[model samples]
Target: MCGIVGYIGKNEIKEILLNGLKELEYRGYDSAGIAVLQDRELSTFKAVGKIINLENKLKDFSTQGFGIGIGHTRWATHGKPTEANAHPHIAEFSNVVHNGIIENYQEIKEMLQAKGHHFLSQTDTEVIVHLFEENLKNCDDSFKAFKKTIDTIKGAYAILLISKKDSTKIFYAKNGSPLIIARGEGGIYFASSDAPLIGLAQEVVYLEDGDIGFMQEGDFDKLQNIQPLNINKSFAQKDGYRYFMEKEIYEQHSVLLETMMGRVSEDRIALENLDRDFFEGIESITICACGTSYHSAMVGKYLLERFAKIRVNVVIASEFRYADFVIKENELFITISQSGETADTLEALKLVKKHHLKTLAICNVDNSSIVRESDRVILTRVGIEKGVASTKAFASQVLVLWMLGVFIAQEKKLINAQEIKEQAQAMLKATKATKVDSKLHERIKRLSKRYLHGHGFFFIGRDVFFPLALEGALKLKEISYLHAEGYASGEMKHGPIALADSHLFTIALMPEHLLFEKIKSNIEELSARDATICVISSQECEVADDMIFIPKASSYMEEFFSMMVALQILALEIAIKLGNDVDMPRNLAKSVTVE
Candidate 1:
C-alpha cells in the first residue's frame, strides 16, 4: 500500500503537496516524492525515507509559480525502498503517481521494450507512465490516452496522471482500490483516503471501480466531470486530540453508539440491510479476515456459539484462500475488513462466490468491494480510522458481532426482548465506563519503561480474552518493534511458559469472568519463575507485580470492551514511551491492498 495525493490550487504547490503527504503518511512511509509542473516542464524530487527527507531535498529546488503537483509516500512492493523506486514517476509526456500492484507489468514491459521504450527503475509503477507516453502517440486527447493506458494494465490500481502538455489539469482513475477526490477552499484535491483532505476539502467524492475523472485549477463548482458525493464534515477535525490514535481510542464510546444506533431496541435487533430470510438454513458460518479483523472474528466465534448456539469457524484470510478447505452445504461465509479492499480477504471472497454459498460482509466503508459483492452486509459506522494501528474500528467490529449474536438469539427464540434490551443497556453502560485517565497512562508508561529492554514479551488470556491477548501482542509489536507472543492461558504451560523468566515480561488479561481464577493461576505459575508480571484486570490481585485496573464489568461482553480499551491504552503508552512512531510503524501500511 502507498499514499497518493494530488493538488491543483492557487497556493504554493510544494507546501500543499508536502503537507498532504505528511497527513497521508500512515498509508506508507518507506519513501516520499513529489512531481510538480513548472515552466512547462515536469520536475520531480524524491527521497529514500520519510516525507521529511523529501522536504529537505526540495530546499534546493524552486517551486514558485507552480500550482499543480502530485505526491506519493511508498511502501515498496515490486522493488526495494530506494530513492530510485519512489513514486511521481516521470516520462517524456506524462508524470504519474500510482497505488496498488500491477500484475501484468512484466508482459507489458517486454512489449514496450520491443517498441524501443527504455525503463529507468525496477518498479511496476514506471510501466504505467511509460504506457501513457506510448498511448499519446495514437490519441490526441490526454484523457483518452490515459484510458488507453489503463486498458492494457491489469490488477488493482489508483493512478494520478498529469500531462506536460496540459499542466493545468490532473487526471486520475481507480479500479479495485480506494481513491477520493475532494473540493476545498484552496482547490481540488485527491488522496487515497480522507485523512489528508481534512481542513483542506469541504466536499469529498469517493470513486468507485472503473471511475475516471479529473480536476482543473478553478473547477471546484463543476460537478459535471465526476459523480457528486455527499459530504460528511464530521470526520474533518481531530476534536482537539494530540494524535489520531488517542482521539480514536476516546471515540470508542461514540463508535459503539453509532454502530448500534437505531438498530437495537428494548426487545429486538434490526439489521435492516440483511433480508429476513437470509439467515434461514444457515447451519454453520466461516469467518475470514486478516490482522485486527481476524481477532474480532475469533471473539465472534465465542459469542455466536455461546449466545446464538451456532457453530463457527474463524480462518485467516490469506491462508484460507490458498488452503484446500471445504465449504459444506448451507454454510455462510463472512468477511470483515475496515477498508473492505484487503487483497487476501477480497480474493477469498471471490473464491467463495464461485461456490454459490451465501456471503456476508462486516465492513466500515459503504460501497466497498466486499460490501458490494456480499449477499448481506453489516456496515460499521466507525467513520474513517486514520491511525495505522486500528482502535475504534476493532471496537465497532466487536459491537456488531455482539449485536449479531443477540439478533440470532432472538431469531431462534432463545432470548426474549426484555433480556435483549437489558444486554444492550449493559453494553451502553460499559462503553461509557471504559475510560483511560492520565494517571493510568502514567502508570503504564512506568511499566513500559521498566520492561523496555526486556528480551521478549508474553500476553496470556483465557476463553474470549484469548483473541484479545493476540490482539494486544500484535499492537505492542507493531508499533514498538518489540518481540512478543500471545498464547491461551491454559496452553502457556504446554510450551510458552518455558520461555518465561526474569528476562521476559508477561502481560496477562485477567477479566472477572468464568476463567478468572484459571488465568490467575497461570499468572501465578509465571511469577513462581520470577517473571515480571503486568496484569490487566478488573481488580488488583496479589499475583500482579503491577496492576492496570479496569472498571468491573457487569457482563463478559462488557468486560471484553473494557479490557480491550485497557490493552489499547497500554500499547499506545508503551510505544510512546519507547519513542517509536505510534501512527506509522516501520515496514507496515494502514491498508494492505497487495498480496
Candidate 2:
C-alpha cells in the first residue's frame, strides 16, 4: 500500500501537500516524493527514505507560487525502495503518483520500449506516466488520453496525474484501491484515505471503482461527476495526543461504551442483522480472519463455545479458503475484519457463500465488500482507526463477540435473564474501571530498554488470554520490529520452551482466574530456564522481573478488557522507547487489499 495526496488550491501547494503526506504517513513510509506544476513546468522531487527525507530535499527547491501539486509515500511493491523508484515518476508530458500494483506493467513496459520510450527507474508506476504520454500523442484531448491510458493498464490502482500541457488541473482515477476527494474553503484535496483530509474538509466524495475525474484551481464546488459520501466525522482528530494510536489506546473506555450503546441492556442484546430463530438452529460456528482480527476471532471461539455450548473453530482466512473443508448445513460462517475488505477474508466469505452456507460479518467499515456479501452483519463502531496497528477496533470486536455470546447463552436457556442483566452491568462497570496510569507507562518504558536488544520475546497466556497474548506479541513485533512469539501456557513445554534463555524475554498474562495457578507454574518453568519474565496481572507475582498490575474487574470478561488495554499501552511504549515508527511500521501497510 502507498499513500497519495493531491491538491488544487489557492493556498501554498507545497506546504499543503507536505502536511497531507505527514497525515497519511501511517499508510506508507518506504519513500516519498512530490510533483508540483509551476510556470507551465512540472517539477519533481523524490527521496528514498521517510517523508522527512522528502521534506528535507524540498528545502533546496523553490515552489512558492505552485498552485497545484501531487505527492506520494510509497510502500515499494514493484521495486526496491530507492530515490529512482520513489513516486512522482515523470515523463515528457506528465508526472504521476500511484498506489496499488499494475499487474500488466511488464507487458506495457515492453510495448512502450518498442515505441522508443526510455525508462530510468525500475517501477511499475513509471509505466503509467509514459503510457499517458503515448496516449496523448494519438489523442489530442487530455481526458481522452487519460481514459486510454487507464484502459491499457490492468490492475488495482489509485492514480494522480499532472500534465505539463495542462498545469492548472489535476487528473485522477481509481480502480480497486481507495481514493477520496474533498473540497475545503480554499481548494480541492485528494488522498488515499480520509486521514489526510480530517480537518481540511467536513464532507468528502469517495471515488468508487473505475471512477475518473479532474480538479481545477478555484473550482472547488463543482463535483457533480462523483457522489458525496456519508461518513461519521465525529472522532477524526487526535484529541491532544501526539499519535492516533496513543489516542485510540486511551479511548478504549469510550470505545466500549459506543460498542454497547443502545444495543445491550440488562436482559436483552440486539444484533441488528441476526435472526434469533436462525441462531437457535445453528449447530457449529466457524470464524475466519487474519492478523489482529484473527486473534479477536480466537477469543470469539472461546466465548461462543464456553457460553453457548457450541463447537467453534477459528481459521486464518488466507489458509481457510485453500483448505479442503466442508461447510455443513447447520454451520454458520463468520468473518472478522477491521477494514471489511481484507482480500483473503473476503475470498473465504465467497467460498462459504458458494456452498449456500449462512454467513455473518463482524467488521468496522459499513459498505466494505465483506459486509455486502454477508447474510448478516454486525458493525464495530470504533470510528475511523487511522493507525496501522489497531487499538479500538480490537476492543470493539471483543465486546461485540462477548455480547453475541451472552445473547446465544440466553437463547439456549443456559443463562437466565437476570444473569444476563448482571453480566451486562458487570461489563459496563469494567468499562468504567479501565484506566492506563501514567506511572505504568513510565515503568514499561524502563523495562523496554532492557529488552530492546534481546534476541527475541515470548508471550504466554491461558484460555481467552491466550489470544490476547498473541495480539500482544503481534503489536510488539509489528511496530517495535522485535521477534516475538505467543503460546498457550501449557503448549510452552512442547517446543517453545527450547528457545527459552536469558537472552529471551517473556511476557505472561496471568489474570486471577481459574487457570491462574496453572499459568503461574508455567511462568516458573520459564524463569527456571533463565528467561526474564514480565507479567500483566491483577496481582503482583514474585517470579516476575516486572509486573504490570491492572485494575481488578467484576468478571473475567472485564478483566480481559483491562489486560488488553494494558498490553496495548505496553506495546506502544516499547515502540516509542525503541525509536521505531509506532504509527507506520516498516514493511507493513495499513490495509491488506491484495493477496
Candidate 3:
C-alpha cells in the first residue's frame, strides 16, 4: 500500500528518487523520505508528511551524480503517522524502504533486542534494516544476506534495501504487492505504481512473488534465489488521462474487446467450462470474495441463476470459513479476487480446498497462489489498479463474470447465439458510452453541501442496481465518513420511507428497468418529505432535483457504468468538501497485500 521507489544509474539520484516519489504521491501521501548514497557515504532525508515536505527540506542540498537511492511514502499501519514512524527506516549501516505488512515484526524485534540491537521507531519496516545489518555482519554478500533475512520474515512485502558499503547497487524484492521497474534515459528506475514513470519509459517489468532484482550502474539482473530470472512486458495504450483510474475507466472498451475476443465470432458464444469434465454432474456453484470482488460474486449469483438456471450462492470470504454450509461432492466453488492474495479470501480458499471441493479462481493476476491452487483459473486483463478504491478492476471482473454467464447459458443450449450477441453488443455500447462529463460534475458539486448537511443517506435501486447502490454508498462512507445505507427501491416503502425527511439525501439508481417508474414514485415520496434527490439513470427523470445521465444500456450493464459515475462524483465532491486528500485517503493504501 505504501509507495516504494528506487533509482540506480549515472544521474542525480536525489532528484530522480524525489521526482519519482512525487509522481507516486497518489499511492500514499501521509509521509515521505529518501535515502541516497553519495561518495561512499549514506545521506538520508525524512519528512513526517507529504512529498512537498521532503522537497522543501532538500531545497539547499546538491542533487548530483549519485548512482543509487530509495524513496518511500508511508501509510501507517503499526504506528501513528509521526516523524518517528515515517519510512526510509535506517539502522546503523543499512537503509530500507518497505511496503506491505510484517506479521511477526514484534517477535523479530524481541529477538534482535536480545542480541543488543536497539530500536528507534515503532514501525514494522524498521525491523528490516536492523535485520539486514545483522545479516551483513554475518554474511559476505549483501544480496545473500537479504535473502537470508527474508527467509525469517512472515507476511507480504515489496522491499528496497540499500547499504553504505554498496553505494552503487539497489536490491528489491516483492511478494503479493505490486512493484514495477523501468529502464530510463538516466538509469534503471522502480516505483510502486506505474503512473510515476509513465512518460519516463515505455518498457516496464513487473516483479511477481519470489522474484528479486539487483540493480547497479546501467545494468541489472533479476533472480530467484541465486539463479537469473526471465521477465516479460505486456504493452498497453494509455491514451491520455491524468490518473490510472481515469485511463482504466476509459479502457473499458478495450477490456470488452478482450472479453469478446474469441467468444462472439459470428453469433455463437460458447461456454467451455461447463462442458468440461469438472461440471459434468456438478449440482451447484459457490462463490466467495471480499470488497469489490464480493459484489462481482453477487452479480455472478444473479447471472448464473437467471441465465443458466443453476443453483449458486454468494458468500463473503470473511464469513464463509466460519459458517457451516452444506457442500456436495460435485458442487463447484469459484473464488474471485483482484490481487488473488486477499488474506480472508485466501483463507476461505484453503478451507474449501481442505474439504476436497472443486475450485476455480477468477483473478486478475495470473500464476497467483489462488490460480496455482485452483483446479481452473480465469484471468482478468484490468492491468494495474493504482487507486485504493477499485474502479476498472471491478468493471473487468463484472465483464468476465457476465461472459461466463453467457458461455454457460449457451453451453446448456438454454440461450441462442442471437440472444447472447445482443447482450454482448449492449455491453460494448455501454462501455463506449460510460462517460462522466462536465454536466455531471456541476450537478455533483451543487449537491455536495446538501449531502454533507443530511443526517444520513439512503440509496435505493432495483435488480442489479441493488449492488450498485450498495457500492455507491460504500464509496461515500468508506472515505467520506458519511452515514449511509442502501436498499432495493421497492423495499423503500417497507421501512426506509420512515426515515425520509428534509434531512435525508436520497440517491436513487433508476436504470432502464421495468421497475424504473416504481423507483420514480419512491423518489417522489422522498421529495414530498422534503428530502433532496440525486438520480443516476439513463435520462433525466421527473423526480430528480439533480440528474446524471449516461448512454442507454441493458439494466444489467447499467450497474457497472452507473456505479462508476456515482463513485467518481462522490470521490471528487467529498474530497473538496471534507478538505481531505482525494487521491490518497487517510489510512487507505492502493493494495491490501497483507493480513
Better of 1 and 2 by TM-score: 1
By lDDT, the candidates rank as 1, 2, 3
Best by TM-score: 1
| lDDT (Cα, tens digit) per residue for candidate 2, span 1-595 | 5788999866787888899888776565688899988778778889887778888888877655547899998887877999899989998868999987888999999999999999989999899999999988888789888889998899878899999878888999987677788887767889887767867775577776788877786555676444444555556667888778998888878877888898888878777767578685789999999999999999999989988889999999999988898778999999999987677788789888989888999998776667878988999888788789988888889888888888888877899888888978977976765556677667776766777877999989999999999999999999898899889999988999999999999999988864889999999999999999998888888999888887775577777877887788878888898788787788887777666
- TM-scores for all candidates: the values are 0.92, 0.89, 0.83
Clashing residue pairs, backbone N/CA/C < 3 A, model 1: none
| Cα lDDT tens digits for candidate 3, 1-595 | 5778888776777788888787666455588898888777888888887788898988887666655788988877888888778879889978999988888999999999999999878989889999988988888888898888888888778899988867778888877666777776767888876656755665567677787757776564442222222222222333565445545555665665665566554476653343446567777999999887887788778778888788988999888878887788888899998877676777788788988999988887765556767888777766656555667667777777877777777777888868877877766655655455657657667767766766988888777677777777766765677788888888877888899887888888876654777778878888888887888777678867777665566654755565566665665576568775555666776555555
Give the Cα lDDT of each candidate.
0.84, 0.84, 0.74
**C-alpha positional error of residue 437 in candidate 1 after TM-score superposition, expressed in Å:** 3.6
Query: Which order, best to worst by TM-score?
Result: 1, 2, 3
* Candidate 1 wrong stretches, greater than 4 Å: 9-11, 59-67, 138-144, 166-168, 184-187, 199-204, 212-242
What is the clash count of model 1?
0
lDDT of 2 at 218: 55
lDDT of 1 at 109: 93
Q: Clashing residue pairs, candidate 3?
A: 271-407
